[model samples]
Target: MNPKVSIIIPFYNCPYVDQAIESAINQTYPNIEIIVVDDGSTEFKEKLAPFQENIVYIRKENGGTATALNEGIRSATGEYIAWLSADDYFLPNKVAKQISFMMRENVEASFTNYNYMDETSQPIDHWTRPVFSNNDDVYRAFLNYNAINGCTVIIKKEVFEQAGYFNPNLRYTQDYEMWVRLLIEGYKIYYLDEELTKFRIHKESGTYKHQQAMQQEISIVENEYKPLLKEYIARNLE
Candidate 1:
C-alpha cells in the first residue's frame, strides 16, 4: 500500500494562497492529502471558495505560523508530512519524487533543493545547497547554518512524534528550532539534489519584513543549541 502524505499549508492574508493550494492539489503523487490552515486572516472566506472542496480547510484565531502548522499536523491522518508555505508552491512531481527517494533510501526526513521566485512566481535563482557525505555531516552543517527549507521538507509523522512539534513561542525561527531538535535526537535528514519546490520572495514575506526579529530569534536558537552542537563536533573530531 502506498503511504499517505499530508501537505500542510499555513497562511495568513497572502493573495498567493490559491496558487499554493493549486500546486498541492495537482501533485502527481496519489494518496496525498492537502490541508490548509487559515491563521486568522482578515480576508474574506470567499477568497478560498474556489479550492474549498479540494482542500481540508481549518480556521482558527490569529496565531503564528508555528501554531498553525501544529494545528494542521494534529488534524493530519497521513503517515508523512510536507509543509508548503501559502506564498510558495511545489512542483507537479515533488511529492512523488520525494516519497520515492525516502522509501528507496529508507529515511524518515528529507528536503530538496528549491528555486527562489518572485511574487509573480518567476524564477530568480536556485539555491545550491552543500553536499554532505553522510548524515552526520548533514547535522553538523545545520549547526552552522540552516540548510533545510521547511517548504522543501517531507518528514515522517513519527519523526514529529519523537522530536515534538514546532516551537509555538518562536515567532521567527520556529522551523529552524524544530530542525535543530530533530538533528539532536539523531534523526537523519536526507537532501535530494532536485529542485522540486519554489519559494516566493516578496516584500511582504516575513523574512523580508521582520529581518531584525528573525536574526534575533536565530541568535537565541543558536545559543540554546550551542552546547549540543559543540558536543557533536567534539565527538566527530575524536
Candidate 2:
C-alpha cells in the first residue's frame, strides 16, 4: 500500500519559504499532502499566496516552531508525517525514495543523511554517514541528531503521535526533547544510509544560537527526560 505522507511546513517570517514550498509541491510521491502552517506573519504569510491552491495553508498566531508543528500535526491526514522547516528545503526524489525505504523495511520511522547548502545552494560539506550502534534507534539518535538532519526524517503517524505534540515551551531543542520522549514511549526508528534531504543552514533558521538557546533547552530536556534517560541525559555540572 502506498502510504500517504503529510509534509507539514512551519513557516515563520522567512524569504526562503517559497523555495521550500516548491520543493514540497513537486514531490515525486503523489500521495502526499502539503500542510503549510503560517505562523502569523503579514509579509511572509502572503508569500505563500502563489501556491495557495496547491498546498493546504493554515494561519495561526505567532507562538513558536513547536506550536506551529502541533498545528500541522493535528491537521495531518497521512500515514506518515514529515516536517520541513520553512527556511530549509528537500532534495528532489526525497519523498519518493524515503517512502519506498519505509515500506520495504516496515519500520516505524526513517531518516536520511543530508547535505548543507548556502543561499546560492553551494555545497557546505558532504556529511559522512555516522555509524550508529543502533541503526533503528531513532530516538537515541535525536539525543545527538548526527544520524540525520531533523528535516531528513519522515516519521510514522503512530510514532509521531506517541511522542506527542511538540513541546510548546521549548523554543530551541524541541526535536531532541520529543524524539527522546518517543523512545521512552517505545517507538522503533531507523535511518537510511542515503543522503536524500538537502538542509540549508541559513542565518534565519537552524539551531544557530546554540550557545544561548541550547543551554536553556538542555535544562528543559534534562528536567523532562532525565527521569527517563538519566544515563543518556545526565546533568554535567562541571
Candidate 3:
C-alpha cells in the first residue's frame, strides 16, 4: 500500500492561495490529504471558497507561519508531511516522485530543487542545488546558508516528533531553524535533483517585503547552530 502523504499549506492574506490549493488537489499521487491552515487572514479568504469542501481547513489567530504549520502538523493523520507555501505550488507529479524516491532510498526526509515563477505564474528561472557527494557537504552548506527549501521538503511525521516543530518565535527563519535542528539531531535530509516546486516571486511576497528582518533572523539562527553543525559534521561525516 502507498503511504498517505499530507500536504500542508499555511496561508495568510496571500491572493495566490487558490493556486496552491489547486496544485495540491491535482497531485498525481493517489493517497494524499490536503490541509490548508488559515493564519487569521484578513483578506483573500474568499479565494479558499472553492476548495473549502476539498481540504481540511483550520483557522487560527494571527500566528506566524511557524505556528500555522505546527497546527497543521499536529492535526495531520498521514504518515508523511509536505509543506506548500500559499504563494508557491507543486508540479503535478511532485508527491509521487518524491515519495517514491524516499521509499526506495529508505530516507525519512528529503528536499528537491525548484524553479521560480512570477505573480502571474510565468516561469522565471530554475534553481539547482549542488550535487553533494556526501552528508558533510550538505551539512556544511547549511552552516553558510539554507540549502533546502521548506516547500520542497517531504518529511516523515516522526522526524518532527524527534526534532520538534518549527520555532514560533522565529518570524522569518523558522524553516531554516527547523532544518538545522533536524541536522543537529542526526536526521539526514536527502536531496532529490528535480524542480518539483515553483516558488512565487512577487513584490508582496515575504522575501521581497522583509529583506532586512529576514537577514537579521538568518544571522541569529546561523550563529546559534553553526558550531553544533560543524562539530556534527566532523564527528560523523569526517
Measured against the true structure, the TM-scores of the candidates, in listed sequence, are 0.95, 0.87, 0.97
Best by lDDT: 3
Model 2 residue 140 CA deviation (Å) reads 5.8
lDDT of 1: 0.88
lDDT of each: 0.88, 0.77, 0.92
lDDT, candidate 2, 1-238, per-residue tens: 7779999999878888999999998888889899999888777666788997889989899998899988998989998999998877887799999989888987777777777788777878855556455554544555554234678889877765655787898877777777677655656567777777677766766476466777877777867675765453333211
Q: What is the C-alpha lDDT profile of model 3 across 1-238, one tens digit per residue? A: 6899999999999999999999999999999999999999999999999887889999999989999999999999999999999999999999999999999999999998888889899988564445666556778898788888899999999889877999999988899999998999989999888889999889998889999999999989988999998998889877
**Roughly what TM-score does model 2 have, to 2 decimal places?**
0.87
Q: Which stretches of candidate 3 lie above 4 Å from their native place? A: 126-133
TM-score computed on alpha carbons, candidate 1: 0.95
Highest TM-score: give the candidate number: 3
For residue 33, give model 3's deviation from the true position in Å.
0.8
Please write out the lDDT profile of model 1 over residues 87-138, one tens digit for every residue.
9999999999999999999999998888888988888865455666666676
- Better candidate by lDDT, 2 or 3: 3
Model 1 ranges off by over 4 Å = 126-133, 236-238
Better of 1 and 3 by lDDT: 3
Deviation of model 2 at 8, angstroms: 0.4
